[model samples]
Target: MNNLLLNKRIVISGAARGLGLSFATACAKQGADVVMLDILADEVHSQANLLKKQGLKATAWQIDLADASNIKSTIDNVIAHSAQIDGLINCGALATGVGGKNMMDYDEDLWDRVMQINVKGTWLLSKALVPYLKASSAGKIVNIASDTALWGAPNLMAYTASKGAIISMTRSMARELGEDNICVNCILPGLTIVEATAYVPQQRHDHYVNGRALNRKQYPEDIDGTAVYLLSNLASFVTGQNIPVNGGFVFN
Candidate 1:
């Protein structure tokens, strides 16, 4: 929480709540000017105001990741406000209430929705911001994936597939952006306690808690330190890696 991120500006998606909110707070604490983007405009604005009241640097913008035009406009406005975008945290996704069905029971609409938001959203947002990231002296990208994808978690096929794709995309993005000195990486967190995972079955939660080597529940905060590290100069040499931050629930 020192001045590691001082003078750095980071844009976090899905910042209205859940894990994204945790990332926003952590980045602010580390002295980064935080740009919070989410479809929940009111909530993100309120959260940014809260950060401001805490004497932290934060801004809010509404962005629908699934909509390309919205993403382009938001990116332009973000640049207009400040041309330098030092980092990006791709945490936005349609996670809440998108589970509880087996792959066979999953409808085409459900699968497409998950892919459009979770997979395509990550791609589109990163695509829109890479130019700014490339322009930075040191640029970093952290794509939030999931342990479910590593373990092939049942009844969550579509959602898991989307996250799996993110992990792969992280590697490809890193290679493409490396020439610009932009480091792209992925984080695979076990099922953490957040608003997005509130609907998860108790049984699944128990499995995560008991299966982990730590033998404890994971929270959004558990993922923050790793995120802060990846976003800072501390990880300047790191890129295209899939880090599993699930307290040893599953090895990647």
Candidate 2:
């Protein structure tokens, strides 16, 4: 119990599995009351319950990123129950239709769905929660992006583009919310080996691992420390920054 996030109330999207679940558990371990929101209702609830059994403050909610009404209603419900929100981790994203498809061959509907969920969903959720965030003494937002956007990986145009938008939006949000003392930043991860990414091809995984300074694969745990720092008081002065946790894959 490092308690780095003592007394803070944080909300995490896509908290059922993969990086989202990792972040939820990490925050809870640091003494933050976490609200885990995911489309996978049962898995998320079970995860929260497991944390509770460990004597951590954790709750779960189901949400669909594509539905604006659902996002607003879920947030409202969270506020009604949690009363205040101190931080937000936007890890929810649609990465489907991203691999092995060039721009010319990419399906229109798939591209639209990816953008709608990854870009628009992130914006809407942040916009809807800004009020509660502003009410906190130290409000912070961490937008999960991908290093693919920085280096422009091949065959993943839509995913990379949507992440690019997230980086841009993080900058804009930081400037806009600076007046309200809300800090916003983006985290660009490399090819992390999470369950959600288990489908990634072996060659792709090797490419990421071999190109890294660490000469190893990145995992969900590799990102947890930076996330904790960003949401902690230690990073109050840090905003509008894009920090890559990709084991030195792309140096900025």
Candidate 3:
């Protein structure tokens, strides 16, 4: 609403629903031209249409983020659509469902798939988009991480490991991209109750809520301000940092 991002172009992954959609909406409200990428083609296009109706310049692309070749083409298309990209929000993730398996019970294929999408996808997508971000004097990259990566959740080995890699990547990207005036950071979100979490076992949900200082589930809105702040000029001095959007769930 303050027009902090006016005339800027932003790209968000996983913008079909949940936190990613929230980020897209917020950026649009601040007058940013947004391009959303998601595996769910119909849902993403519908959302983009809605944003367009609201007078925001928005577009949608469907792509499998796990493949490096696909990521390169997707990033190139986005850059071609908009002369420059000012920010990127890597909010897409996978491997959130199968958590009850122990080390022995975990399937190798499942583990590999998790790492491929959650870790490799984020890295490749960021790498592919760096050139566009670098073209802008004020560029920012925000990767969405999870609290599970902090303390580590039992039976969630693959998801935790991938998120931990995201945290590490954030710092490394910041260091490498700073010279280009692009700021890279990570956001650690807590138990944000979205449609996806409905599939989570009740016991696990209770476990997360009880551990939080607020003793409540987090909502998509909880991360909005933090996301905007990190991408705004106010955070010009901030880079290689991790800001937990969880309700004090994990103190670091």
Model 3: residue 145 alpha-carbon error in angstroms = 0.8
Candidate number that wins on TM-score, 1 or 3: 1
**lDDT at position 103, candidate 3:** 80
For model 1, state the Cα shift of residue 188 in Å: 0.6
lDDT of 2 by residue, 101-203 (tens): 7889999998899999999999999999999999999899999999999999998899999999999999999999999999999999999988768777899
Model 2: ten consecutive residues of lowest lDDT: 94-103
lDDT of candidate 1 over 37-62, digit per residue (tens): 99999999999999999999999999
For each candidate, how many residue pairs have backbone atoms clashing (under 3 Å)? Answer: 0, 0, 0
Q: What is the TM-score of each candidate against the true structure?
A: 0.98, 0.98, 0.96
Error of 2 at 150 (Å): 0.6
Put the candidates in lDDT order, highest first. Answer: 2, 1, 3
lDDT (0 to 1) per candidate: 0.94, 0.94, 0.88
Candidate 2 residues lying further than 4 Å off, grouped into runs, are: none
Candidate 2: C-alpha lDDT? 0.94
Model 1 Cα shift for residue 34 (angstroms): 0.2
Predict model 1's lDDT versus the native.
0.94
TM match of model 1 to true structure: 0.98
Tell me the spans in candidate 1 whose CA falls farther than 4 Å from its real position. none
